[model samples]
Target: MKKSTLLIILLFITIYTYAQRDQTNQEPGSTAFWENLSKLCGKSFEGEMLNASEKDQFYGKKLVMHVRTCEDGKITIPFHVGDDHSRTWVLTMEEGGMIKLKHDHRHEDGSEDRITQYGGTSSNSGMSKIQFFPADQETTDLIPYAATNVWWITLDETSFTYNLRRINNDTAINVKFDLTKEVETPPTPWGWED
Candidate 1:
């Protein structure tokens, strides 16, 4: 009995040592955030509208967000509302270690929508749990009305949030997804196969 107990203790010590080493070896800066987000791939979560504009009727129904694709330097998440699956949020690690967020909107015919691929890059090396993106010049050129838009995303043990606020206007949208609840994955977003 004593021999068995000693073997078990040794095994736990080995596991703990490796776990500590892995934590210490994690990449610095936003890499931690990227890694955290990547861990959610292949999972879907239900979300609630914290605050939305009156015209934002599209999000007033059952909402689900799935971490669909995750790659070396990019992750694409699909947001589905009711029967609409036209929106996907793409996060990419840009040059100089910055992060960029883009909205990929598409139609049912596998074509891009008129207001697609407009977002911004992170202005700082944000914490592993949160990041803020301000409108870029390209976004301003593409959507003149959203020249002063800012988007923020946050993730923690309990929930994840996607928030948007316009500096020029009083527009604000916040959607919170419960991380503890794993829901059924929704259908593919528009323009995506399978």
Candidate 2:
């Protein structure tokens, strides 16, 4: 009888531990959105330009984004456009349940770009699959003309979309990647140690 009781207790403890892990992994409230994004770590996806009306030359090439690093409070994705591997998008969970997005651009020699680290922070805890970042004070100071920029990211089972629009200027950029099919992981982004 005592053996059976101990066996039941062990089983209950195991189930309880798993439940706690699940809860922490898919926490409620603000962390829900971040947890969704964190699911893509160590994966690469191919993308295409969604807003072809703009006729931008840079984005017309083969585009790939690799979700390289993921931690408790941060995820780093490197965006590669053709042969240029200079841009990395960093998503960091900030205090007050806010999320911050920063673009780190570098040159072939691993030097920082003149306009690097330009991104914004979330104004609210967005939906589980989408988050919007309005231009923060840092972006306005980096490039005054981009003061009205608003960036948003959406993630679902089939696709992930990154979007940008200048509220006052009508400038827009939309890039969508296929989440259903992951491509081969690309090389390290600029400035990253091998």
Candidate 3:
């Protein structure tokens, strides 16, 4: 084979290899999961605490969640428990296809709370229906007792569940919402712009 032809073939092979690697690193599973969740934007659902205890603060409250905002690489969900609209769940797609979950908490005056923005990034490429976020360093720094916390979310055609578990402990919270039913969207969460 001619030297020029050989060089051309080598370059083509290198480009193809790099392209494949880049695509693979994009984490198709995570992307699919994001897309699936984004489809629920602007919808609202009523939720119930699955493992509620008498001492659980959220017990017997009217729990609602709104998939209020969906933007490129980001989704914002506001969780309302009775009259408390201080919590919003933000899912951001990070570089290399990871997803970061952050809880934005605010007071009635729309001011940031002291224990806010604590969550973690997905440790691996989770399935299209679920993803797990272990406590990130920032979370541990802000809330030392939550260092062992792991939060996972699952979404399907009929339901969506948000769960938290503390490794090596019995502390857990599981809230499941019925996707089959659409509820009225709640008001803007605290600290969120209209």
Candidate 4:
């Protein structure tokens, strides 16, 4: 074969190999779920507590969640409860078809809270519309009481729900948002601008 033709063939082979490697590294279902959630980027939605108790801190407050930032491998969502802008959920894509969920809590001055960056990674290749994250070691170490907390999110065409349940216990929280209606985007979450 001509030297130039040989070089061109080798280049094509290298490109094809790299493409296949990337595809095999990601879990298809997780990737689809991530992309679906990413579609809501820059939009804000209003939500309500599905199981509210009088003792619940967020029971009577106006709840909002803004899918504020979306990037190649990460998505940042700031959750607002009435006047508080202290909670942000950070979802990051990981190797081997896994996704990590971390709670980024900040103060008004954009400083990290003492209890922050606590969450877990997906244990399996969940469905395209849902994923589950069991509390990681960091969460258990930071808050021993929440060692059994399992957080899961479900996204569909019309609604999105964030849920938490402690294994072998009765503690659970569920918040459902209406995706059919877009709400005014809230201000930035604490400590994010910096």
* TM of each candidate vs. truth: 0.83, 0.83, 0.86, 0.85
Per-residue lDDT of 177 in model 1: 96
C-alpha lDDT of residue 18 in model 2? 100
Error (Å) of candidate 4 at residue 116 is 0.7
lDDT of 3 by residue, 128-157 (tens): 899999999999999999999999999999
* Residue pairs with backbone overlap in model 4: 110-191
Q: List candidate 3 segments past 4 Å from native.
A: 1-27
lDDT by candidate, in order shown: 0.90, 0.88, 0.94, 0.92
Predicted candidate 2 versus true structure: per-residue lDDT over 15-117, tens digit per residue: 9999999977765445877777788889999999986753686555989999999987989999999989999999999998889999999999999999989
Once model 1 is optimally superposed onto the true structure by TM-score, how far is the C-alpha of residue 179 displaced, in angstroms? 0.5
lDDT per residue for candidate 4 within 1-194, as digits (tens), equals: 69999999999999999999997786688889998999999999999999799888889999999999899899999999999999999999998778899999998998999999999999986889999999999999999988999999999999989999999998689999999999999987888772
Please report, as a residue range, the 10-residue window in candidate 3 with the lowest summed lDDT: 23-32
* Candidate 1 stretches greater than 4 Å from native: 1-27, 52-55
Q: Of the candidates numbered 1 and 4, which has the greater TM-score value?
A: 4
For lDDT, the strongest prediction is 3
Runs in model 4 deviating more than 4 A are 1-27
Q: What lDDT tens digits, residue by residue, belong to model 1 across residues 9-92?
A: 999999999999997787656777888899999999999988665578755699899999998899999999899899999999
